[model samples]
Target: MKEALKSFFGLDDESDDDELLSKNLNDDIAIDPDFVMSTDMLLAAIMEAYRVMDRDKDALDLFLTKYEHMHENESLRLMSEKKKKDPSLSSMHSSKEEDKQRLVQSANEALRTFFKMNNDEDARLLFRSLNDSSRTAETYIIMVGGLVEKEPWSGEISQLYQSAVQSKCLTEELAFLAMKSVVFSKLDGKMRVLRDIIADTSSVLNISPEEFNSSRYWQLKRTLGYRFAKLLMWWRNLSSSWEKELKLSVRQLKQGRQGGHVIDEDALRCIVKFAGHNQRDDINQGVPVSDGPSEKDQVIQNKERKYGIKLIREVVVDAHQTTLYNSPAFVDDVAIGFCSLKAYDECIKFVKEMHSRDLIKLKQSTYEHAIYAAEEKKDLKMVDELIRNMEDGCSLNIK
Candidate 1:
């Protein structure tokens, strides 16, 4: 039987019985008889068996059995050392408090970088990472200070201000500085938020009148008052209550004898004119009626006294010369007041000069009045010369 087996298996002719027995022993335990077994595969098989059997002690025993032989390899030695140091393998949990502290420190460093760069995305991420409220406040202080100093991203300044207000993470000094910066930027949204904050602080903290009057506080107050007045004047088409508030606020502003702050006179005049024009005498008492020879009327009277007769003569001459000849409102206003009382030649010359500059398109009524004045003058020759000059000098579509 042994001779038949040796012929079938291709065994060496000189192989001893012990060698044959050892070969048979390995074959019986082999996982894959067709494949060659490696040292790693054998180790893996032992470890997997121990795992399936829930035999941690066996796993340790098997690992120890092979470790000494594998430890001589540098990669194997390093891997074994790493496994020993691993907390999960050693039944230990790392200190989460220490980990949190490390994370916060990392977040703060990132925040500092964000402030320097003014990278909004990075700043936002750093702010989100901060778990400590005090640290969050400090981070925002640096950010706000940098923003104020640099004025980077001016368009987004309002958004940043809103974020700061919502966070409520700024100190009073920081908030004051932010408010002042908003004024400098002239951002309406930031200004509105600042006003609300000031009003709320005054209401909540019971801040004294003396404190409100302090140099720093009053500077802020004055800024608010002046800005409110300007807003009122510039945004005049707003609701009546808004206009009233603006007037009251402006009156409350600590103005010198001349005026409070550098008021935009153009804006103020437009606001006053708009209000006067829209005033309802029925609803309001003692509304000043603009009568003849009043301040407004005096302005008209002065212009009439100065340029009225001269403008009339020019319009009459221009009307006779060309069908396209038209006079502007200022010229017509002057002509209407004095055309009958003055000569035609002077009025035609004045109208010609005004037409050259293109400043006379004041109103349609003023134009009609000038035409009437020309018809009344009875100076057809002067009117014809005026029209010829206007047709040659001004656009033919003048009316």
Candidate 2:
């Protein structure tokens, strides 16, 4: 056994480095394969030795080329034939299954070691090279979990997730990890990442919506959609370029929902807030002209503002008509959106519908918007009603 260790590391007993090598190969011990030793155990020891020596890629390569093939169907078949003669061969069949599990465990250990060494390229390559049978979901999860923890802000993690999706190896847990990592990362192009996740989740649901219709799954989609919409707000400026981009974002949201990516209430809230801002910008445009915007620019702002108001009304009406998530917060944003465009009547009507559903506990800002909208419409009765509404559980701070 000592001689095997020496030979494994290209050493000999006559070498002067015996004491140092002894300390390094501490895991190597005398074992009888007939009693307890297995290929996985030996491979693990060698891989650990390789990792300690900073040659983890070699360990991965060894696992890929040799230890993974420990599951030999022909050997199992021969053993089955032998079992006909001797009942003792049943243990051999069980050992074969155990060896397969050990091989998977060994693969996981190698992957974790590669990640520990910061040799992500080799880890990625090793995972990709694995056949479908060898690549268990746990193996994939461990690889991605290591990557995310080691480098949470890396775009490479997102790419690895995409590759897993293409290979059909990305489980729901993996998808959740990838989504969270991407969101937490300071990486650019987050909207694109969200879109990718939406598409991936949609694919899974398309197969068996009933079976896979988990709350956690829908929650992930809702979180992604909300974030995507929040990011869209940065392009809310009335500049020509940003206007086009914002329009594209809105269209993407629509198309996503149409394509089976559920746009939940949280996402609609952000869109409502965005539309409110657009309407406010339009209101600012209508104020006394300055040397700031050209006549053509004012015309464009008016068109975009109209589009924004139209969007908010559509969203509010859709929420009311459909049995969707109509939280009080979402309804608050809807009220503010209508008031921003001085659409007092529409705002009040929607508020009443939501109030009837017990979803209209207005926040301070929404209360202020309602007050201002009623005043703008010269409706004293409406203003008094808003004051009464504020007296009942609504904050009355009008800024």
Candidate 3:
């Protein structure tokens, strides 16, 4: 080991100049991978010993300890700067702080390269080599993060996200960061990331019903809803029919492997709107594809309308089956979605049906949608009836 160290640093041990050489090597400016022990050689030796001894963690810990040692003094300088009160001391140590950051960053880069995470296939193989690899999240985050940088919206990103959540290695902060990355992926117009993240919603966002009232929750829901709408459009373009697209999109929304856990009403309504709009659009423009249909079929277009109604009903029924139906926004958003979809009769019918079911403590938006739908239909009597219903429900006696 001593001879190997000497050969690594081009040392002349016979000259009794060991102390001089060691001092020169230790100096901050001279400290580098080559003058110090060759990290490559050290790593190879450690790995060989580890393989023979049948150890993985110990070898990694050994490499980490040695590699991190190179930055220890610089890191300590940063801590000292943080603790010091004197302005002069802070100013004097600014350069040292920068150096410390650089040292730490360099160490991380070196670790990434050493672990072969800079190459995706190798990184994946390394993860798979571990038993119950998904639970190895703590060890694999940095490596996977580097891999994600190369392919932000790939199947691998979603897999890593799901694994990280499954492994319980995801902190709240990391969870939001990953979600934000998915939202930002849309700037590149990648719908797959949006769909994948939504598919992993229970793991990715995972907030409870209690926090539903918070502005942050609504904000996140709105952002997700908007993205879902865009994704709905993309799905529509990909499929031959709205039913196929809606089914595929619903499949994407299911939670865990069992396909339970419905998405909340706010985001679900976004999907509903797109499904209905395609029906309206197809009716207006004639069937996009030829299918043994007359002009009467175009006018009657009941298949698209029926499929839209079925899709929306399925979403609402799933919510009712789950605890999310109790959310106050549920009835309101569903009504608004129906109105937005121009299913005026369906919108009014939903309101009456929900009231009959007594499942809702109706919000003002529900009445507003009912009234708006009546007005659009030029049904004065229905408008008056909705106004009285709103007064009885929420005292919104609007003129």
Candidate 4:
């Protein structure tokens, strides 16, 4: 018995367990004829071995063997004629619930042991070994919370997220949870995550980038625009080079048929915010109110500022061409906005299109909008012509 204990735990004679009726196959074999140990002692020793000297697989095999023997013994004891005692007691002998709890406990213990054994490697490998695709996704979902905290940038975390997204057995809510990870990754500034999310989202929304960049996908474009606006607000004081990089990055994405569907009010707001002059006329003090980015290297700084403002403004609205409007319902306001943006030709073209589509009737507001558009062109002749047309169309004689 002492020898067996030593063999099991690499302990000496003072070690605990001694099992009788056990075969010793190590050739140094000996079975203790007089030794006796309780099942409780055996369970305790197995748990201890798990903690101290990891013979986890061996311990599990031994536990299963013990379980079969104990189950047989209990069956025999229950069937005995001497045990025909009490009906109530026999009814209470249903170990199903206990068996369920034991199985759950064993599963938890196995997971603990497996995870503890394999920290440095991807834990997905363990699930793969178990051949459990659904469980793999579930485990990845749980692991992501911690991974997002510790190593959010890890490629392994990304792989796990991808697996969860591709899972076949996911519930709708679970699938959304996986997509939420992709959104967070984009918010974290991962272009790869952003691209994947955009592709999936476009597929679900039945939109392609070709139709997306015009007037088609306003809502989706606005969502991304809001996110970009928040980022631009944070970039208030960064250098001109950074600003240029940001603009160029967006342009590259747009040209590549990626990023926001179209630049709308929200996106324009972001651009305007970025291109704002930090200084304002303080009429009260009769001087300039200046903040952020001192006037050092005035030549280079002024050049960049002028170039940036002009560049981004043109990117949003071109004075030489008709600007695109998102929706046809409020396109009159869009036409006026284009006029305000100095896009006279675009304003004229837009109003013409709206009239052709019967979207804007020949009414007082239509004449007024046409007048505004013509006035932006700085042609008194065109403006007078529109006034005469307005009088003819609406039959208003107001001079």
Candidate 5:
């Protein structure tokens, strides 16, 4: 046994045998066949061997089992040591809760080891068994972040996200990760996954007012709204009708607004573009369908476009009021939306407001809209002034 211990620890010299023997046993234990290594000592050796061999899961199992049996043989060993030092200390031993915590700590370590190994399957399994105690949002982020690129594990990733949220371990960082992963996933029903993440994020944020107003929370909200709107546009064929899609888009926007989320520029642009673009031709190009929309359908279509542009205008004004709006591309998109509605005056007004806010160097589309608005009013002076501003922006390569 001493020789094996020496081999296990990589001690080859005969001189090390005495040292190894003394190292693993008490000074008073006599050398006899019956004087076997204590359970703790033996388990400790095996656990170390497993760790050295990179078998972290196996090491964790043995460690947990040690706690399970610690009440018997291990307690006596501990009591004996304490008694020798002081009689009063003998009565105090580690509680079961402490042992459980130790077990959890070891398990968490094993999880981190597997994560470093890139053995995601093993890490995921261990994470499932882990107690929420001592777990942080970063822990889930690391694991989920690793799995996001794996493509095939989308469902599992979603499940893990749900579990983390339920465990109250989901933070703004993790929430963003979950939403982005599901949005980019190749799997069908990505829309559903995104909605779930949005709902989960909102629910989690509702509990913490400070976090609810955090910059990270705002980022997630904007991303969620933008991605979902783009996704809805992609699923145009799946919608039973244009009006349904329109209602769904408006409904989602309302939810974001009611939930204290700012409907940022990208999301507003997606919805406006979706509402403005007619899918009647695209839907019927290569398939059998009615020649055109019914009169009622036409009115709904008009309402969809007008209502979407209205929302865009309202959100832009609100963003300006809050001083939270700044995006050149968004200005361009809103300009296009206004052009579609023939609200050229409103479009130029919006651009000038952005300019007055020092959001200068606007995009060419915004400048074009402002120029068109000037031409429509037969104001050549205004057009030349707009032309000068556009040239200055171009000289600076603003576009």
Candidate 6:
């Protein structure tokens, strides 16, 4: 037995098995021998070899690889046997909460070992196998935490995040946890992923702009506006020849009647903010006059002829136009003042014109708002028309 053990371990007969075994014991000897090793002698021999080589990692990896495959094969065999016994048994076992928990736990253990080995490629593959949400979440939490701990505030950690996003199997909780892990890393790539996720149209837009501003996504948001503006500003700033032509286009567009249409705070801000001026007073700030024509109209016309577009204004308009435009500043005032005053014709007229001009881009909430406003006014005709127009517009846009 001693000679067989010595040959198995590649150790000399004089070497003490007890001393070597004691040295080879992991800090926590919790793993079952039946699970970690195929036979008692193999376990002792492997441990002895590990002690001789001082290769704890290698031993641990070999043990884990065998353990994982054993469980996986066992699981498959159990599933196959259950299926043969009763096809419904397969479904039953899958649905069993305890089985689900065990699968999740096993997956997590595999992931932990993969990460410990620093085999990122295999770790990612193992993560992909974990399709259950609970298991995926567990794996990501461990992986992300390990990444942050191992390479805190480093670009290498960001690669893991990019991998998660690219995985397509990642859940929101996993994505958020991965994001939170590298929050302090200031990785541009990770920040870009977070921004893209938050901005995903498929998901409900629950992440507010304010929330975006609070997170690492804030840097992205700041640069987004500037980047968008830069495309137009590039030629204007770089080439003197394009400047005059660009100015001409602006003047013509402004002077045109189309200028009065499609005005919103953001669009207006973009126009005015980019069209630089030396003084704040140079920016015409007030509610835009939507009532019967006034001097402001002529000013708009002149500016349009000069710049070729009606520039965005900071002015507050009447509640009627405000509500029509869905401007928040005017939303409450329009609700309280116009609806109570029963200015139904004025409201209906504004809606009809705005709808015809494609000025009021109705979102789900906006459509509901218009319907409620029309109902309160008791103008069934306006409500019906508004609904029809919204439906048609939305359908056309979708198509």
| Candidate No. with top lDDT | 2
User: Regarding lDDT, does 1 or 6 come out ahead?
Assistant: 6
Model 3: per-residue Cα lDDT over 1-399, one tens digit each: 434433432333453223322332224433233343344344445444543454433333333434344356446667777877645666546644443333332233333443542344544543553344223334445555565445554456656676766776665434444555565453565455544444454344565322321313434445455434434344345344445434445544454115565554444544554555544434222112232268776655556656666667777777766655665566676676666556688888888776556455677778788788888899999999888877776742232
Number of clashes recorded per candidate: 15, 0, 0, 1, 0, 19
Sequence-dependent TM-score of model 6: 0.29
The TM-scores, one per candidate, come to 0.28, 0.46, 0.35, 0.28, 0.50, 0.29
How far off is residue 103 in model 3, in Å? 30
CA lDDT of each prediction against the hidden true structure: 0.42, 0.59, 0.51, 0.43, 0.56, 0.45
Which is superior by TM-score, 2 or 3? 2
Task: Please report how far candidate 2 places residue 247 from its true position, in Å.
Answer: 1.5
lDDT of 1 at 130: 48
Error of 4 at 355 (Å): 1.8
lDDT: which is higher, 2 or 5?
2
Number of the predicted model whose TM-score against the real structure is largest: 5
lDDT of 4 by residue, 238-297 (tens): 445345434643454255334434444433333433432332132111112232365664
The residue-by-residue lDDT of candidate 1 on 266-325, one tens digit each, is: 222222222222221211221222334568875654454344233223333433343223
Please write out the lDDT profile of model 6 over residues 33-83, one tens digit for every residue. 444344433653554455356554444344344444445554665777756
Compare candidates 3 and 5 on lDDT and give the better one. Answer: 5
List candidate 5 stretches off by more than 4 Å. 1-141, 150-246, 255-261, 264-266, 274-309, 321-324
10 residues in a row with least lDDT, candidate 5: 280-289
Residue range 35-77, candidate 5, lDDT tens digits: 2223334544555555676755445444443433434544665
State the RMSD for candidate 4: 22.0
Q: Comparing candidate 3 with candidate 5, which one achieves the higher TM-score?
A: 5
- What candidate 3 gets wrong by more than 4 Å, as runs, is 1-248, 251-267, 279-294, 322-330, 340-345, 353-365, 372-382, 396-399
